[model samples]
Target: MIDQYYNHSTVYQRRTQDFAKSRRISPASTRLYTGASMEPYDEELFREHDVKRGLRNADGSGVVAGLTRISDVHGYRKEDGKFIPDEGKLTICGYDIADLIDNAHAEDRFGYEELAYLLLTGALPRYDELESIGARIGGLRLLEDEYISEFPITTKSKSIMNVLQRAVLLLYAFDETPDDTSAPHEIDVALSLLARLPRIAAIAHITHEAETSGVRVVVPAPNASSSMAEAILEVLRGGPDFTHEEAMLLDVMLMLHAEHGGGNNSTFACRVLSSSATDAYSAYAAAIGSLKGPRHGGANSQVTRMHADIREHVEHWDDDDEVAAYLAKILRREAFDGSGLIYGMGHAIYTLSDPRAQICKRYARSLAQTKGKGEEFALIERIERLAPEVMRDVRGTTKPICANIDLYTGFIYNILGVPETLYTPLFAVARMAGWAAHRMEELYGAHRIIRPAYNSVMDDVTYVPIADRH
Candidate 1:
């Protein structure tokens, strides 16, 4: 065990390069951060062995515990972007994401409501069951006046995620059964947050927008008949009207973002917190804080800014050579901040393409065509077409750097008139459903605290007197 070697007599190597070579690991690829850089990010690239084992079972025996897979939560799985195992389809809770999307597009109901049900329960629902769940969640959306009055609307101080986090923490004031962890109580909390956070998020969006634009803003009465998407849109519009097709598209997007299995940072945070027997609000709030990080949820806004920069630099929107050259320059530090990083082009998961990204790209393309604004969309397409090979050549990253869901989401938000600030907040709004589900699963099944131990690298540490310290 690496922990066993931590002592004064343990022959510690001074340099990471020498240590890597001695351990037969790649000096360039081997990464071990001291102090605070290591933030629970266990990547497959960092695995010491080919196969994974439990912490006590693994002894840094080259097992490469690079975090290939962990957690028992089931999501749509595919091999090489094809679901060859189960008749070439992706299934989450026995419901194919593709089929769910297709069925939602075909159905009159808001697909997201059904998706939330599927995630909360382990099975897909019949029409009546789905409708019943929808009405149940809808009725749970009401908030007391004092609760509504205390909510934060505009903030240059706190982050959107923090606002959501504090909002959940504040729910403790209204919560009479804070000590309750029963399934029925948890489900009630989950459904209430699912229905209510959106309204609060929508108000936050309008307040922020109006604050920025110097316009006095007020939220109108919510429509009881409106679907989730329609309700969120109505709050934004300050009325009870929105186009049906647009709401459908928004519903699909929200469904797609609802859950990505339990391994994701935010969802994992929810499970871990729930394992500590914390209330659902605390667990869900931890997830919001996790999603607030740029590496996780904020990538969407970064992509938006990246697109703006690319448009300013590229002289010809259609030229392949121009796009390639600009991309190369950006990667090579000859242009654009010299960071040598490409945002929204790579996903840590999925070797070929993220299926959700493909769906989102199609929606973005159709929207562009309908609106007759293809320049930026065309530019995005060009980057997507060329980025895989270009990024591979630029940085020797082991994984395929293809388009991910973040690629088009920011643009889609812009198309829907959502402020850039609300991108991550809205992500939290949608992901709350998944967080609640995970929290419930963790609390109900695990019945243990998720406390993990850390190993220290330093072996020799002697206390010094104040004079020696000086």
Candidate 2:
């Protein structure tokens, strides 16, 4: 069951425990941060500190715990003079004078505040509210059904992600525009899109496969439009043929990838829409565009390509020296960065290691064993060990550039019999939940249009009249 406070102590403890076990670290090794400051990994110590400091929990208890915003209420500031409180909003926009003038170390170049707003607010959607929104949105399941039925017979000319883009644009036509006091009504629209986006995405996949393979793919119409996992499984399995384990794994993946701390394409879309007070459709369109980029949702596809390239040359990589030479050649040529990147290695965030990557690695190992393709598992292991060394020597960097979650997710999905092309759309299916939650938060508050200031890099110049042209 979903909890009342999304970032409650129970939730943090559960996550910390899970992450700790996955990383093979002690429970005490998993540090819970109240604010932006990094602290020692001791839950009890942090809890005690909170209690003594009179920090209130989300439930208004005297003790505040959990990683969400407890520190915001207690009032802490970074060494750079930026305030980090346990309550109220924290703006991270480039346009904010404090962020620009004082917090010069802030890395975000655009829409940082919008990203923070989405992450902070969407972390905890009210349970009752989510249920109501889910119910209303589930009603829009027919749109997906119709779109799948009408999809073109030949999808070779168009990518699955492109089809998804078209489907979203078409679906948006059916959405209603809320009145002046439309935030409340718009909540229903946001919820509906979130609930059904996976179904539409999955259907797009099934239809694309059918068109490409000339095989009939059939899926049951969603009964209640419930969980995104259920909808995707219904489409993927096409009936009650899938085992309980398969369903469970799909659900877990959906939930895990639902949201991180923003800074993604879909979340960016939500922020952009909030800034303009535009409807969810327009906002989502912008998000879809962002997701198409190689640095973002395209990571999984890169993973597959990298795997294929390595497999083609696997016979030559007999030793570490050979691997090093090959990697140096690729790096010197800038092959991955320009010719097309090797997917699933490195990320903009999480310099240490991506938590999601760890989960996907576990999932992929299980899947590899299940499929009896031990070679795939072995390949991943080799890549993990060798890739870092290759990168380090080639780039002359000491830090390890490890494979992120997208790499493992791609391997897992491929082993599970999903087509390679559908990887990014699958990411979209998971992210829609976070997108909806962010939209809900934007509608609920004293809605501000997210407008961030930018540094003027272009030179100031005046245009000459056409009549005086040389």
Candidate 3:
């Protein structure tokens, strides 16, 4: 077992190194500084242009632009029919928002129905189309035998997400038609990957959990199940002990989160790699790396921790006054910015509420009722009620800064006996479908490489020798 583990580690490391090498870019040869004046400088005209443009809101409120890129397709719009860019140079903050948040953007923050529309439709796939995709993938479960055989299993107690990452890389390696981004095959590959990823994820989860707990290696029962969620639930339950309700909820959650808009970590990974003409596996591996970031796929863990903290101090959280004082103290001590920021609350795109959040919230409430423990539900309600008020008091705005799907999903999964660590992996399982869909779209569209230009504003200076630096 030890030798086998070392071998797996060696292979995994080699593959990782290879992936890094493949994705690397050589530095630009000609280094030109923007600040360097070209020939005759038009300072007077530049000043005049700046004065006319104004310091803020240079483009006026009514000006609108459309984007063909994955980042710009938030499904919701304001009353004026103008879609807000979650993260772009045009937004208040020039930083890119998390892909998950960007994908969930709707006219109303709480537009669950709109989200449902996106999930059913690939790029606004219609209701019937969504049903077809779901039906097609539902019957497809478990990875191909070759995939299962080639999947690298290390003895080290690895992060499940990391294992999934390796699996994604391997998927690229094993892709029979790495260069074929055309019709039927591309669509088929996307559907197959979408169907099997949940099983792969569950295998990773069960394998790692078994290793940690010293349980027997139970090869997941052959995929006799109809739905991908059911197959995974079987693996998790280890026998026929799993409940029907749990299976149904898991199915819905997986289906709902399968895809949103695009430009999320995994989807971005798909887009970036597909742009470069890489295969699906390579694209997916890149995405997994992006998802590893705390701001992206790791939000669920943070949400869980916040809930835990609140629950631990539930006695102290008597009323709005006490909650305000506690929150203020934490903020002051932590030097937190008054952004009304809370884990799993407020979306960059959605202003009303996250539809997924609503679904998960309902499921969580149901689970609480089933278990007859109202504490979690009560805590969620209190936080939901208090969060907006707290934000309003601190930030001078009472906009609907409700909890997103991550928070609700975290709550539901926690109540369902899922370890907090597996939360993101589960997210990955559901999101694999969306990632595959986006990758297929990019590949079919033959989009150009996603290399966005950067505008620098820093002053230029000459490099100095080390000895003469001072």
Candidate 4:
């Protein structure tokens, strides 16, 4: 493993290995390079601006300001309790998210292949460009050079996020030219990965199913003819009847979540790592680790767990008052171990009900109606309609109380036969486009090492020797 790290990986611990032996040949240790180093800039300037309060305007506090936008494509502005991402800027790469939604409900839906081109290249593709991308992506799905199948594929009580994190490293291993960080090369790596990651995620699930069901699952490579949803359908619920509407619906989900700017925890991980001029593989692998945190990409699964906890207390969901009581009691910590939290009720960013959540909620209704899951839809619908009031009245929560994107996506994902464990892996699949674009932007546009300083808590300290301590 250490040899692998030394030879292949750009990890910190291994970078310093064989330090004494390598010093003679190292170009970085030369006197000329050392003498030419730039002067240290003032760290206080960042502290004066209060930049490191988690990038907030003050020490862990601020109203919304200064969030960066890479794609003005999905522009949103909150006004009077609603998100009005106007019809035009919502047009990503000349195609509207709304039109895709309309198409999903009506005819065959466009796959993420089209959106990948838009986000990575920053322009809408013609038919020829789209076809070329689709072909290229389909061809890149197999992990032939660095096959993950050789690794121990266990899934019993194991986190799928961890599995995905490992698989990203596998992608890094697959790249023959891992250290090529030039803009053109990195873009190709990112694009190749955009097409490959969904299949990687699907393989993790397939392995899990194989372990649990005691059946051999022959995971298929990505096919250009199949939409991502159709591929997932065949993997999870196998048959020839992978419907266009369902595949398109999932396409919409991926497109909607594709990008939300670089401030998000995972995308920010991408920015920071790539700022060091690290390879695209390491950058995205770092991002996968960040997304594994329960706070970032785990909310959709939390929404499912919250539903389970709610069911343990409130059996009857038809009564609006009863549902409200359950929500209030949970927020007040009278139920669910008196945990003073409702998992899917609010967001860190969006002040209004999340626009993505709103879109997903509408789609959830359609799925519920179509699949005769009206009861399931009604329960979350009551929570959606009432949770804000409960938060305001019971917990004295001043911050906005609204359904985040996680709230509604679970129901729709459940309809699509996805389990809770796979929820965040799917998130990685969707956010890959955004992560790739942000990392490349950091590399090409504003190329600075993303080193932030921490304010020292203990300004003065005395060291005690071991013998003198007692």
Candidate 5:
């Protein structure tokens, strides 16, 4: 009994010390740490060193890094050695995205599964093949009870994406062969995650609401026969509280967001991690972390917040001059987070247009009209039209600019009753297909590690003794 008491005392003492050490850092120490870690580089140094900042060329094109058979993003053309803006085109595997959407809608079938299959395998599936694929993914939609009971929704994170990242990492512990990078195992893991992530995101959103509002939400068990889009809505709404049109619209959205070429930030992050021979879960978790950045998948939420601010401050949504004035203020760093960026207004590659945004714009208008939110949709449309002009006038640049997919997706989600918190999480759900595809490519196609060289700009200095440093 004495020995047991002594051991317990020692463990408790260690835990107490750890708890005390984990306390928030003092403000003074934080300032000192930030100052010591600060490293600022001059813009001119990039040009002098012939460096491609952010791996982007001077004309804003991504540096040709690797090849891809998954999808192609075409936004510009070169003519006579001059940069030329062109209508954006997104092709998945070998099929055009617009044609895929059109065919799926015409047939009145969910297309996200088909798109996912095409991304994973570089070919469109026949009817029977598509049925098999859907059945497999739908069957995997229901997560393991242990996972639901122990992870994600019960955790303390307010950010759904953070929960999602943890949920994915947690899966690594459950898999019997988590490190298997063979084709069959990798594909199975990818499909399982593609099915399970939407459910996790829905539960994470509910968990966040419970924490904030103290109202517990019960997520319904997923239907194995339901499509991915339908399953997400059912879980989030706690039942089948959505329409056929709503489900179809969301399915189209999933297809459009499923892949955006290999160079996209999240997919590239997945590729980079996969190139290092990590497990599928780690690579996917890294992709989720990258997507959570405000400049990437999180841009949809930023766009929503910016629109909300415009709705609150602007007097009239219909008046072009009034909207233009507010947008000019945004571009001039005088309003809306003061970052000098009209969020969702431009794309890195798409200058003339974004094909995904074009489709969403059409569907968003129809849905907004039905939901009696025509005025709000009109305001968003107006912003899309006027933001480029305002930017040109404010910044004095002649660059062609157009709205990206982020602009209309938030409006669509709102009409569907999705919360702002789920905006980026939903992006992760859709882009899981892309990230998995890229991971496969990096593992199988690219045999070498991705190691980019960085040019050091800091001057070498002699080390001083600890007593003489100050």
Candidate 6:
């Protein structure tokens, strides 16, 4: 079946190329096509129409779309039509995220699988239930021999995210009931994906490295580790050389990222697709594509690169004045990608703080010290401290800005020996739980197709025949 699909795709590509060669487009035609594009609308029209651009209210708060029992993200208070920044707090299934992680730490156990179960089921599992879910995930972790060997080798995509998306969409072909929308079946498919995506990402990363270096890469088979964090480290490193502290930190990272409400871009994309009652695979694939955007899941890698540039250009990491000057240059479109924006310095929902960032910083500080990177870590801390002040002086930003989770995620991954290519893919792996939970909610709870209205600004005009045109 895979071979047939590949052959058809090859033929289609050939026909498309042949058709392209048969056409001769003149420069005048190209100019005409470009000129036919729509012009930007006046900003006044948005005020006159009371349009909520980007689904956000005038106060920069997201317009409430729907309700869910999955999780809540709180970062501000509204009183008497005023927005007041507050310390951020995140809860998963009515449990404080800090408490959950702390309890897991006290018990010396990994918590991602437990969090996955809670996100899907909306309740904490018992002792037996936890063990059962872990065993189920372990059982589904290994891909079939053909699936593992054929897809990664044949497909030529260098991006791990693209390969992961392709692998997920293709898994539908192997499902016995790919179109099943039943709750039981959806849960099954979600669990299968949660177990398998890490392995798929690992293989894609290894394959790209091998192709580039011309070194033979030995893909590790799935292991029966006690936790998803351990399994990920083992498979990525091609052996069991990681320590207890590293695995525990990875587990905390996964738990922190597992869910961020249904309103996030990728989860919302999933909900939009699921509202149409599509199959689970299509909804999840769409979510993966959404997450691949730079504004969303790709920000961690950007932050890493931006910091590297800072380390290169800034001579004195300890000198606050020098760091602030470089940051001001970045805001003035003179340095570090010239976008005039810091990558990891702000959050849409959190104003004064992001609880996840706060928690990740604590753990990252310890890891940085252990790995002999305290200087680099302190440099990052200085950037976080100075970026807001620089933004205010240069960009005239009035509202409060805080360091988001991306500020520390890339640093943490580096400490864990993870490649930059896998940063966003690993985000997707943890986010699969959230995506699945929200997809199920949209399918079962919402039950209405999402169709938002768009006000058209173009005036109607009579169509002209080609011969009658100017």
Candidate whose TM-score is highest: 6
Prediction 5 global C-alpha lDDT: 0.88
Count of backbone collisions in candidate 3: 13
Where does model 6 exceed 4 Å of error? Answer: 1-26, 29-38
- Residue pairs of candidate 4 with colliding backbone atoms: 333-338
lDDT of 4 by residue, 1-470 (tens): 32444344334333344442466536445433333132222445456655545665441223332223355333335578554433223444445665645654564547576677777887767889988887777666656733655443532337777877776676666568889988778878876777667776777777777888999878655466665556556655544456667777788788778876667789888888888998888888889889887677876787788887777778898888899999888887787745567777776555554667778888899899999999878998888888988988986666656677788888888887777778888888888888988888788887588876665433575998989964
* Runs of candidate 4 exceeding 4 Å displacement: 1-52, 58-69, 72-96, 99-107, 145-157, 238-241, 337-339
Which residue pairs in candidate 5 have backbone atoms (N, alpha carbon, C) closer than 3 angstroms, thus clashing? none
Model 1, runs deviating above 4 Å: 1-90, 153-158
- Greater TM-score among 1 and 5 belongs to 5
lDDT of 6: 0.88
Compared with the true structure, model 5 gives a TM-score of 0.92
TM-score winner, 3 or 5? 5
lDDT of 2 by residue, 145-170 (tens): 35545553322335667766666666
| Residues 1-470 of candidate 3: C-alpha lDDT, one tens digit per residue | 32454445455455445554565623231112211242222334435445422112232222221123332323244566544433211110111223323443332122222232353233544557546665666566656677777664531336777877787666665667766767676667666666666667767777777777998767555454345556667766675557666666665566556565554556666677778987666777777777766677787787787767666654655466665655554434442333224777766555555666766677688788888867667777777777777767655654456667777777777656667767787777777656765676666665567764433345788999989953
Q: Which has the higher lDDT value, candidate number 2 or candidate number 6?
A: 6
True-structure Cα RMSD, model 2? 19.0
Model 4 weakest lDDT span, ten residues long? 32-41
TM-score of every model versus the real structure: 0.81, 0.66, 0.70, 0.80, 0.92, 0.93
Local lDDT at 208 for model 1: 69
Candidate 5 root-mean-square deviation in Å: 10.1
**Model 2: lDDT of residue 163:** 65
Which window of ten consecutive residues has the lowest lDDT sum in model 3? 87-96
Cα lDDT, model 6, residue 324: 97
Candidate 6 residue pairs in clash (backbone atoms < 3 Å): none
